[model samples]
Structures are given as C-alpha cells and as structure tokens.
Target chain A: MRNEFHADLQTVSQLLVELAQEVRAAMRQATRALLTADRRAAEAVIAGDRDIDHRYRDVEERVCELLARQAPVASDLRAMITALHVAADLERMGDLADHVAKTALRRHPSPAVPAELRPVFTDMAGVADRMAEKIATVLASPDAELAAELDRDDDAMDELHKGLFGVVLGADWPYGVETAIDATLLGRFYERFADHAVNAGEHVVYLITGHPTPS
Target chain B: MRNEFHADLQTVSQLLVELAQEVRAAMRQATRALLTADRRAAEAVIAGDRDIDHRYRDVEERVCELLARQAPVASDLRAMITALHVAADLERMGDLADHVAKTALRRHPSPAVPAELRPVFTDMAGVADRMAEKIATVLASPDAELAAELDRDDDAMDELHKGLFGVVLGADWPYGVETAIDATLLGRFYERFADHAVNAGEHVVYLITGHPTPS
Candidate 1:
C-alpha cells in the first residue's frame, strides 16, 4: 500500500510537469497570434486552455485524495500541498495566455502589436517562454538552483515590461489611445505571466528546501 | 480529539471571514484614495496589505497543521481544502486593492480617475466592496444562496468595466494616452478583485454542497 501511494504521488508530480509544458505552449501560441494576427493560432491557444484546465483539475483531485486517504505527513504532506499550489499557478498561467489570445482575436485581421512595439513583445514572449520552460524543468527535478534562476528571468521580463511602457508612454508615441490601451494590457499579461512563473518557482523551492523563499 | 480538531477548524473558518473583511476594507479604502487623491489613504492601503498577507499565511499554516495532525476526512477535509483556496483568493484581492492604491499614488495630488470617469469607478468599487462584504458573510454562514449572489455582482462589475473602456475609447474622450492607460489598468484591478471574490464564493458553495461548482 505504501509503495502504491508513492507511485500515485509520482504520477501527480509528472502531471504537474506536463501541465507546465502545456501552459508554455499556450502562451507561446498566444504570442504568435498577437504578433501576426493569426486568428487560427489565437483560436487554438484559446481552445487548448480547456485541456490545460482539465489536467489542472486532475492534479487537484489527486492531491486532495492523497491528503485524505494517505494522510501524508511531513515532506509527503508538503508535496501534496505544493502539487495543489503549483497546479493552480499553472492553471492561472493558462488563463493569462487565454487572455492574451482573446486580446489578439479582438483585434483580428490587424496585428494587436504595432510594428515598432513588436520587438518588445517578441522579447517579452521570449523571456516568458524561457521562464515556462524552466518552470517545467524545475518542477520535474525540484532543483532549487534552477528555480532561483527563474527569478532573474523575471527581472529581465520586468525590465522589458517597463521598457514597453516607456515606448508607449513616450512623448513622441504615434499610436492612438486604443493601441495604447492594448499595449498597456498586453504588457500586463506578459508581466503577470512571468510573475506567475516566479510564483511556481517559489512553490518548487519550498518543496525542495521546506523553507519557503520569502515573497 | 475530534472536538478539538473541529475547534481548530472553526478557528480557520473564522480567519477566512476576517480575511474577507480585510480585503473589503482594503478595496474600499483604495477606491477612496483613487477618488480623493489622498496620499495618506493610499499609503495606508498599501501598508495594510502586509497585515492581510500575514493573516493569510497564518490561515495557511493553521490549515496545513490541522491536515497533518488531524488527517480530517469527508467534510472536514473539504473544509480544510476550501479554507486554503479561499484564503488565497482573499489575499489576491488584497493585492489588487494595493495595485489600485499604488495607481492612485502614482498620480498623487491628481485623481487617478478623471472627474468625468469617476462615476464608473465609483460604481465598480461599490460592486467590488459589496462583493467582498458578501464573501465574508457567506464564508461565515456557508450560505450557498449568498455565495451565488456574488456572481451577479461580478457580472455587474464586468458591465462597469466594459462601460469604462467605452468611455475611454470614445472619440469624444479628451484624456491623453497616459490617463487612458491608467483607466484601463485600474478597471482591470477592480474587475479582477471581483473575479477573485467569485472564486472564493464558488469555494464556499462547494464546501456547503460537497459538489464542486462548474468553473
């Protein structure tokens, strides 16, 4: 029975890694849709979110069940709790990706990002993608060191996010208010994507060290 | 032993209500600061968020401890799970309020919501404040009916949020890109506050019925 519980726990951990991978893809696709105004890609990201959510719910149910039936103590208990928190962060990351996709769809036919601002978004998306990749890797390995690296990546994302505002709010900005609003919100989406990645990293760090890195 | 476990469970539940109340006050004070351009109010709201976070962590530790020590099953287990989820939502709500306060401070001495668009923000804050209040009441009483009503309030918030965009994007709008950006982000802060409240309400509904609500 104890062996079976460990196997189930391992399955739960595997699902978390898979969930992270899905969120990474969803956000990347959403960024593609945003940059190129590809309706199909946007639709795909929006649609794929349901699958991510399904997997997230699967994690939740398994974790709750393990806590109840296994009555896991100490590190095992922390693992169950961390699985739930990590799954939730992954699920929310998927939603943020969906939000980005929906924004792309809202401005269909014309790119939501202007030509000049596209590179900034491309950079932001690049950082976000790398962060998501690292998130999956850390969740799979529970490496405290890699998780710490994601924080530096988050700082880079924040720098890009701030630069985005500088460009949009620049005195000579050529875009109208509508584009400004879109830029503002889009920047928020990517910034928050990175923030959630950092949050997931924090959870993984806690799982490994049993000492939560201060928020 | 069973009775003692429940007493601890009750303490956790009571903390959830207090959390909801703190969130309500935080958002309300944040709204006041935005409307009045009161730097002190904004600072207070920002500083108060730490207290909210501290309480949130307290709830988290107590729930995790109860789960480890008591190994509650059935409704007791559901209650523990719900408490964690609800506390998280409340904490996020508090953060949203902090965002609103910071927005106000960034525009200090000059109101974040222009005089013309102030009414919409007023209405949004009113809806969010009421939702927070209702969240506290529902958590305290575990009333599915009241919890369900928070969804209606969320819809109201969405409408206000939409109307805000319409006004900002209107051709007659006189504000510059910066104000529009501020309005867009502010609208989002309130909208997400309401979203988190609905999330907490769903958690409560699940706790009461033992049947998960469709997300």
Candidate 2:
C-alpha cells in the first residue's frame, strides 16, 4: 500500500510538470499571435485555453482523491498542496493568454499600436515568454535558485512595462483613441502575465523552502 | 473533541465575516481618497491594507488548521473550502484597493483626470462600495438570494466602467497621457474589484446550495 501511494504521488508530480508545459505553450502562442497580428493563431490560443482548463480540473480532482486515500505527510503533503496551487496558477496563466489573444483579435485589421511602439511590445513579449518558460523550469525542479532567477526576470518585465507605459503616456504619439486603449490594455496584459509568473516562482520556493518570501 | 471542533468552525466563520467587512471598507476608503484628492487618506488606505492582509492570512491559517485537525465531512467540508476561497478573493480585493491608493497618490496635486469625468468615477465608486457590502452580507449569512443581488450590482458597476472607458478613450483629452492612463487603470481597478465580489457571491451560493454557478 505504501509503495502504491508513492507511485500515485509520482504520477501527480509528473502531471503538474506537464500542466506547466501546456501553460507555457499557451502563453507563447498567445504572445506570438499578438506580435505577428495573426488572427488564426490568436483564435487557436483561445480555443486551446479550454483544454488547459479541463486538464486543471482533472488534476485537481485526482489530487484531492490522493489526499483522501493516501493521507500524505510532511514533504508529500507539501507536494500535494503545491500541485493544487500550481494548477490554479497555470489555469490563471491560461486566462491571461486568452486576454492577450482577445486583444490581438481586437487590433487585427491594421495593427492598432503605433509603428514606433512595436519594438517595445516585442521586447515585452520576449520577457513574458521567458518568464513562462522559467516558471516551468522551476516547477519541474523545485529549485530555490531557479525561483530567485525568476524574480530577476519579473523585474526585467516590470522595467519593460514601465517603459511601454511611459511611451504611451509621456511621449507624443499619433495613435487614435481606439488604438491607444488597445495599447494600454495590451501593456496591462503583459504586466499581469508577468505577475502570475512571479506568483508561480513564489509557489515553487514555498514548496521547497516551506516559507514564502517577505512581502 | 467534537465541541472544540465546532467552536473552531464557528471562529473560522466569524473571522471570514470580519474579513469581508475589512475588504469592503478598504475599497471604499481607497476610492474616497482618490475622489477627494486626499493624499493622507490614500496613505491611510495603504497602511490599512496590511491589516487586511494579516486578517486574510490569519483566517486562512485557522481554516487550514481546522481541516487538518477535524477533517470535516460533507457540508462541513464544503463550508471550510468555501471559507478558504472567500479568504483568497478577499485578499485579492485588498490588493486592488492598494492599487487604487497607489494610483491616487500618483495623480495627486495636479489631478491627472478631467474634472468632468469625476462623476463617472463617483458613480463607479458607489457601485463598487455597494457590491462589496452586499457580498459581505451574503458571505456572512450564506444567502443565495443576497448573493444573486450582489451579482446584479456587478452589472451596474460594469456599466459604469464601460461608460468611463468610452468617454476617456473616445476623445482627445487635454490632460495628455496621465489622464488616460489614470482613467484606464482606475477603470481596471473597479472592474476587477467587481469581478472578485461576484466571485465571492458565487462562493456563498455554492456553500449554501452545494453547487457553484455554471461558468
């Protein structure tokens, strides 16, 4: 019975790792759709989110069942709790991707953002993509060091976000009212995406260290 | 042992109610600080958020401890889970209040938004305050009817948010970029606050009826 319990634990951990990968892909696809102005790709991201959500519910149910049957202790308990949290974060990340995809669809016909702002968004997109990937790495390994590095990546994302907002707000731009709203929402989407990545990193640290960072 | 378990459960429920009150107060105080351009009031909101955070964490720890100790079954289990979720929503609501306070501080003195748009904000603030209070009531009593009423309040807040964004984005305002960004972020804060309130209301219904609303 004990051996079977460990086997189930291993299975749940592997599933969490896979869920993180799916979440990472969803984010990447959504970012690519935003940067390249591809309606088809954006639609795909929106559709794919349903699968992610379904998978998350599946993991949640399985984890709860494991807890009821196995009654995991110590590190095993932490692993189950961490799986529950990471599933929620990954689902939220998928929602963020859907937000980006929806924004991309809204701005499709002629590129809603100004030409000059494209580079800033390109950089922002890169930061978001990297953050998603790093979150996956941290989840897979549960390494305290990777979690710390994810914080640095989050800082870079914040800096880019600040720069983007400054350009939109402080600089003179000719993008009309509609375009400006799109740009603003897009920047917010990226900022929120990075925030969730930071949250995932924090969860990883909590799982390994048993303590969350000071607020 | 069972009596102590019941006592702890009552404590959890009582704290959850108090958390809802603190969250509502935080939202109202933060928005009032913004509308009045009171920097000191905004600072107060910022300081008060720490207490809200502490309360939420305290409630969460208490609920988790109860679950670990008593291993509640059936309705009790549902109630505990609902309390856990309500705490999370309340915590996120507090974060939104903090964001609004920060926005207020950034736009102080010069008043980045147009005086004309003040009424829109005023309307949004009123709706948000009402939503928070109504949700708090529903959470305390676990009333499906009141929860449904809170959902209706969300509609009013949504309408105000949409109108404000339309006005801000439809025309070229004289305040330049700060006004637009401020308006956008302020609209986001109210929208997200309303969203969380709606989520809390749903949880209340779930706790009472044993089924959350359909997504």
Candidate 3:
C-alpha cells in the first residue's frame, strides 16, 4: 500500500543515501588532493560543495512538507526528524571536505602534509570515508549494528589525529610554524568530519531503536 | 485566548533566552581563564558544559512534543524548528567555550595566547559576548533588525581572526610551533563560535521574516 506518504518518505531516504555517497566521494577526493597537492581535484571538491548544499536544502524542504501534510504518527515522526538532522550532518561533512580541499589549495604545488605524515592523513581520510560509507548504508536501511561501527572508525581517526600532533610537535620538525598550523587545522577538519559521521550514525541507531543516545 | 500550546511555546522561548545567557557567561569566563590562566575559572567552564548540554536536550524534547501534540501551523512550526536549531547553536557555543577553557587548562600556569596576543583574544571575546546578548534579546522578542546586526559582528570577528594570524605569523613572533598551534586552534574555536552565533541570528531572522536567506 504505497500511499503518497510512503512514496515520498522512500524518496527522501534514497536522497539521503545519495547525498551520503556524494559526501563520501568528496572526502576521498579532498584527501587525494591533500596527499598529492592536486589542484584540479581540490577545485572539483570545492565546486561540488554547492550542489551538496543545494541537495541538503531540498531534503529540508521535503521533510518539512512531509511532516506538515502527512502529520506522521510517532514512529514516522521520529524517522522524519532523524532524516532532517542527518541531512544537516551530511551537509556539514561536505563543508569539512571543502575545508580539506581549501587546505590543499592554500599549499598548491606543495603537499599539505610532510612526506612522513602523508600516511597519517591518508589513514585518517580512510577512516572518515569509511564512516561516511556506513552512514550512507544505514540511512538506506536502518542498521543499528552497521551504524555502531562508525564509532570504531572514529577511534582510528582520533589515533591518527593524535599521531599527527606528535609529528608536528616533534623536535625534528623542520617545516616551521606555517606548516604546523596547516597540519593542525587539517587534522581538525578530518576529525570533525569523522565526528559528524559518527553522529549521523547515532541518528540512524535512534531511528531503528527509538531511543536517543546520551549526548 | 492563550492555549496550552501558546503557554508551552512561551516557556520554550524563555528557556532559550536563559540558555543563551548561560552560554554567553561561559564564553566570557573562558576568556578570563585564557587571559589570566585562572585554573578555577577554566575548571568552572569545563564543568558547566554538562548543564548546558542537559538544557539543550530538554529543549529538544519540548520542541518535539510541542510539534507532535500541537501540529503547529506553518508559521508556528517554523518558530518551533528554529528554536530547536538555535538551541543547538547555543549548546555548541558552550562546547566552544569549553574548548577555550581546556586550552587554558592545557597550558596551565601559562596563558594560552602570548602576552601580546592577549588583547586580540579579549576583543574577540567581547564581540562574541555581545553577539550572544543580541541572540538572547532577539529570542525574547523576534527582532529582525537585531538579528541582522550579527552579520556585521561576524565581519568584525573575521577581521580580528585575520589579525590574529598576522600576529602569529609575524617574523618577530617569539612563540614557537607549540604556541602557534595553540593560538591557531583557539582562534578557530572563537571564530566558529561567532559563526554559529551569526547562523543562530539568521535563524531568528527567518522566523521573523518567514523567508530563509540564501545558504
């Protein structure tokens, strides 16, 4: 019995999944630019963020309209609300990706991280991208188990983030103040990206379990 | 002809104002901690963030209940949703203040920013506190004009933020990589705090005008 409400909710879920995929690609691309100093890849990520924002707004409008017209019951209401918050998280993930790209651009013709630290940035991005992937997966079908995995990925990101500080603060660090600042900020951007992914995963867990996790 | 819905919504608005004030005080206290290296002040800000998060969650529950029970009309719904988001912004502002406090604590027995940069942080905190005040005022009575002023305040914040980098990057800068990283992150925390305030103000403007400005 696919009524208008069901059809529209389905569409919204699909849109969320697609948006998550877009954000994931953006993160991966930004990391590529960061590791290789690829101006073109960086430019593409920066340009792509607007479309992500546009789609985010589209999701917002749809969710609001759906809530208003359908007057969804309790379960449906929770799903709608969770979708709204997840959309916001996805949009922010896009912004983090954009920040990563800009960091790369700022050091154009120069890798954003030192050669020794490139592996760390790569691993950080890997964890973040994996979290985004799981977020997208859980959105398509609420999987509390799958959603729960993002926390583990986030721990990996934190470890990498801490190791980055170690390198920047190490005595042998010759890059100087500017590079250290860049690395510090870049590390933060990825860490935040991973965090948003984790939050979005929690949103999915709430959707499935009907219990908001402790903040 | 005030119904239960109006009464509940009124309570929500008042709660938001109080939360805004609390967040404002936290930021000011954090700055004091940053400048004076006052361990007690820093510890207070850190401990106080839990209360802020609890209040934020309370607002979220109230808003959801109001929407579900009342099924508010479009205009009222917009206000309810906007309040939900503004509460989130306020809560995050508290988190930023906590970040500032932790930075102060990290360099305990020593200030976070250098002596020369103390004034910059002082001025930045002042503008941020003023912005929080306006947010509280606008929440009490939706004032588009007051909300509009946040953008200008945000511009002032940007100038200060840029000036901070200039000082940090100056050739005569005595602080080495550690202090530079600390200053960079602390500056980012304040800048983000300001940006969230501006966004919250825009949310108020949207509530008043019923037109969401471009993203």
Candidate 4:
C-alpha cells in the first residue's frame, strides 16, 4: 500500500513538470503568432488553451484523489497543494498568451511595429521564454537558489517593457488607434506573463521553505 | 479527536468567509478610490492589500494543516480545496484593484471624463461592486443560487466595457496618448475583476455539484 501511495505521488510530480513545459510552449506559440502576424497560429493558441485548461482541471482532480485515497502527509501534502497553485498559474499564463493571440488576430494583415521598439520586444520575448523554462526547472527540482534568480530576470523584463511603452507612446508616426491598442495590449500581455513567471518562482520558494516570499 | 476535528473544520469555514469579506472591501475601496481619484484612499488600498495577501496565506496554511492532521474525506476535502482556489482568485482580484488605484494616482486630476461617459463609468462601478458582494456571499454560502446569477453579470460587465472603448476610441478629441492608456488599463481591470467573480461562482457550483463547471 505504501509503495502504491509513493507511485501516485510520483505521478503527480511528473504532471507538474509536464504542465510547465506545456505552458512554456503556449507562451512561445502565442508570441510567435504575434510576431509573425499569423492568424492561423493565433487561432491555434486559442484552441490549445482549452487543452491547457483541461489539463489543469485534470491535475487538480488527481491531486484531490491522491489526498483522499493515499492520505499524504506533511511534505507530500505541501507538494500536492503547491502543484494545485502552480497549475492554476500556468493555466492563467496560457490564458494571457491567448489574449495576445486574440490581439494579434485583431490587428492582422501585418501592421508593423516601429523599428526602434523591435529590439526591446524581442528581448522581452526572450526573457519571457527563459522565465518559463526556469519555472519548469524549479518545479522539477525545487531549487531555492535557481528560483531566486527569477527576480533578476523579472527586473529585466520590466525594464524592456518600459522601453517598449516609451517608444510606442512617443512615436511620431501616428500609427492610428489600432496601433495604439495593439501596443497597449501587447505590452500588458508580456508584463503579465513575466509576473506569472515570477509567481511560479515564488511557489518554488514556498515549496522549499514553507512560506511565500516577502512582499 | 473527531469532535475537535469538526470544530476546526467549522473554524476554517468561518475564516474562509471572513477572508472573502475583507477582500471584497479591499476591492470596493480601491475601485472607489480610482473613480474619485482619492490618493489617500488609493494608498490605503495599496497598504491594505498586504493584509489580504497575508490573511490568504494564513488561511491556506491552516487549511493545509487541517488536511494533514485530520485527513478529511469527500465533501470536507472538496470544501477545503475549493477554499484554496477561491482565496487565490480573491487575492488576484485585490491585486487588480490595486493596479487600478495606482493608475488613478498616475492620472490624478484626470480631465473630467466627457459628460457622455461619466454615467457609463458609474454603471461599471455598480456592476463591479455588486459582483464583489456576490462573490463574498457565494463563499459564505456555497448552496446559494445567486452565484449563477452573478456569472451572468460577468457578461454585462463585458458589454459595458465594449461601450466604454467604442465611446473613447471613436471620440475625435486628441485625448492624447494618456487617455488611450487609461482606457486600456481601466478596461483590463474591469474585465479581470469580472473574470475573478466568475471563477468564484464556478467554485460555488463545484462545491454543490462535486465537479467544476461544464466546459
């Protein structure tokens, strides 16, 4: 009976790691859809979000079942509960990606971003991608040191986000209302994606230390 | 031991209700501050969020301890787990309110929103306040039918949001870039608040039905 309980716990952990990778792909896919102005890809992200949401529900149900049947204790209970929180965050992150995809679809036919801001956005995307990867690693290992590094990367994303906003808002080209809306929504998507990544990192710290990071 | 366990479970339920009420106040106070541009009120909301966040963590920890110590079954486990998710959504809703308050600080003395849109915003504030109240009520009594009604109100917030964007974007006034930014951010806060309300309603449904809402 004990061996079966341990096996169930292992399955839950494996699901947590898989969820992280799924979220990372969704984030990348959503960004790619935006950069390329590909309506198909954007639509794909929206549809794929349903699958992510479903996976989150599935994982939660399984965790609850494990708790009920296996009666996990202490660290095992904390791990299951952490799994629940991280899965929800990951699902919301996917939803944010879907928001970006919808925004991209709304502004399709390739409305170009200002050249000056492109580098900032590109950097933001890279940071977002790396944050997702690091979150996956943290879930797999619960490494407190690695989780602490997420804050530095989040700061970089914040800096790039500000630059992106400054360039778009200060532009002289008058790209019209559509351009303004797209820029605003896109910036928010990136900022929130980074925020959720930071949240995932916090969960890792909590899982290891049994407390959330200080505000 | 069983009697003590039941008493702790009752205490957990009471704390869950108290947390819901506190979050609702924080949300309403922040939104009112935004509309009135009350800096002190906004600052209060900002300071008060830590309290909500801290209390949320406290409830979560207590719930975890209960689960570990008592090993609740079936409906008891469901209620506890649902509280965890609902508290999270409530906490995030508080954050969205704080975001709105900060924007209010930035846009202080915001040129009076045009005459045509003043009532629209008031209507929005009404819907938002009511939604927060309903979320609290649902948490206090998961059996209430009011939660389903609140879920429908989410669609009303979306409709009002569309009207807000149309009026602002369609206006000829330069309104400048700042108005555009304000409109976008305000729209986002309202939408997200509604989304959290819907999440709370879904939890209520899950509590009664033993499953999450239908896809």
- Structural similarity to truth (TM-score) of each candidate: 0.98, 0.94, 0.97, 0.94
For residue A72, what is the lDDT in candidate 1?
85
- Candidate 3: which pairs clash? none
Error of 2 at B32 (Å): 1.0
lDDT per residue as tens, model 1, A98-137: 9999999999998899998999999999999999999999
lDDT of each: 0.93, 0.79, 0.91, 0.80
Ranking by lDDT: 1, 3, 4, 2
The sequence of per-residue lDDT tens digits that candidate 2 reaches over residues A28-69 is: 788777778888888999999999889888887787677666
For each candidate, the DockQ is: 0.82, 0.42, 0.68, 0.69
> Model 4, A87-196: lDDT tens per residue?
88888888888888887787687733445656776788899899999998988777988888889999998898888777767757466565676677788888888888
lDDT of 2 at B47: 96
Q: Pick the candidate with the highest TM-score.
A: 1
* Model 4 misplaced stretches (Cα beyond 4 Å): A1-4, A112-116, A171-173, B1-6, B109-116
Q: Model 3's CAPRI class?
A: medium
Stretches of candidate 3 exceeding 4 Å from the true structure: A1-3
How do the candidates rank by TM-score, highest first?
Answer: 1, 3, 2, 4
Task: Give the native contact fraction of candidate 4.
Answer: 0.59
Who is ahead in TM-score, 2 or 3? 3
**Which candidate, 1 or 2, would have the higher TM-score against the true structure?**
1
- DockQ for candidate 2, C-alpha atoms: 0.42
**Can you write out model 4's per-residue Cα lDDT over B91-177, one digit (the tens) per residue?**
888888788778777766663344556677777777888888887776666665788877678889999989888876785746766
